[model samples]
Target: MSSTTGSPSPDPLDGPLAAADLDALVDEWGDWAQVADLLDVPRTKVGTLLREHRLAAAVPRPGAGQRVPLAFVQDGEVVKGLPGILTVLHDGGYDDRECIAWLFTDLGLPGRPIDALRENRGSEAKRRAQAMAL
Candidate 1:
């Protein structure tokens, strides 16, 4: 499904890397409606999740709707430890787009931070995210 119109503007810090970088880093993204379907919740609940820092979404590119990286959810729930990582990143001044970009970026780990979280190796990713906040 297409993203809704009138999405909010990106944060001022959502730069250095372009939206295209995010697009390349993530293999797939799910719009709010799709994520809602996956979680078996109403579309409004997805907004709640985002507000709670249990999830994040971003517009990957101009003309595209806001979307969440498909990797953030597994089965019918958010991947374990993802909310914690998102909190760490957000506390460090990263808006959703920056958080998504950082998670998908490889920083000499066995894989991207998101992969580390998915593999239950979140401690290292959390540490790195903590450092990034400095």
Candidate 2:
């Protein structure tokens, strides 16, 4: 999933993590391990957090197996629907796992944590709502 010749630029998906997409299935099921993989963070980092019991949810099960299978998204679902979270991270001076950690922590909202993943998809809606006041 790293850079490749003629490969799409990083942050290919838009807005938050596109709920329709489950490429991050591991995150949904794998706990920190999958989340780390999706975010490209070192397993050790996330693992350490788990060992220390920092995460709010249950600690991920042992092994790197897919506790939660990942879901994939079509290109349009990401590009057409949202600015893509990867782009936001790129713009936010984030790279690699730290960026992902920041995203997770920020998106780990009180309710509907996944809604943060859809931030980009609804950005236009946000703008429209703001525009409605005018």
Candidate 3:
């Protein structure tokens, strides 16, 4: 498509690519049950966490369910800083999908936000999230 002046229209995929790239960060994402199993929690608790925004489903599966990014889990626990980061992002007016995208995207830190968190840089991640609200 072209604009009224005949300039080529921007690619529809351009904007979506940013969000879409989160899919590439992991070979596969997990469903709620998978996440609950990883965390050693009951499946119902996983639902509560998702509803409370303590955990997020970054992308939806093709058929019916949502997929949680693997980056958020470490050694069977949610990464130390993730819940707080999620809360900050949520307060900053980001939804679960946006929060996941932000975490996976490079934000000029040592690496992606999830990486920083994994490296025990939760404070830095939290700071960045706080900055987003400002």
What local lDDT score does residue 60 receive in model 1, on the 0 to 100 scale? 81
lDDT string for model 3 (1-134, tens) is 84466544332234542345555555558888888999999989888988887788855445646788766778999888888999888887888877887777666787778899988977887998899756
- Candidate 1 overall lDDT versus native: 0.84
Query: Residue 92's C-alpha lDDT in candidate 2?
Result: 50
Off by over 4 Å in 2: 1-26, 29-83, 106-114, 119-121, 124-134
How would you encode candidate 2's per-residue C-alpha lDDT over 10-125 as one tens digit per residue? 23224333222233323554555565676466767655533332222222233444322222122212223222443444345543332232333323243122243354344543
lDDT of all predictions: 0.84, 0.36, 0.76
Residue range with the least summed lDDT across 10 consecutive positions in model 2: 69-78
**What does each candidate score in C-alpha RMSD?**
7.5, 15.8, 6.1
TM-score of each: 0.84, 0.28, 0.79
The residue ranges of model 3 lying beyond 4 angstroms of the native Cα positions read 1-20
Error of 3 at 130 (Å): 0.6
Tell me the TM-score of model 2. 0.28
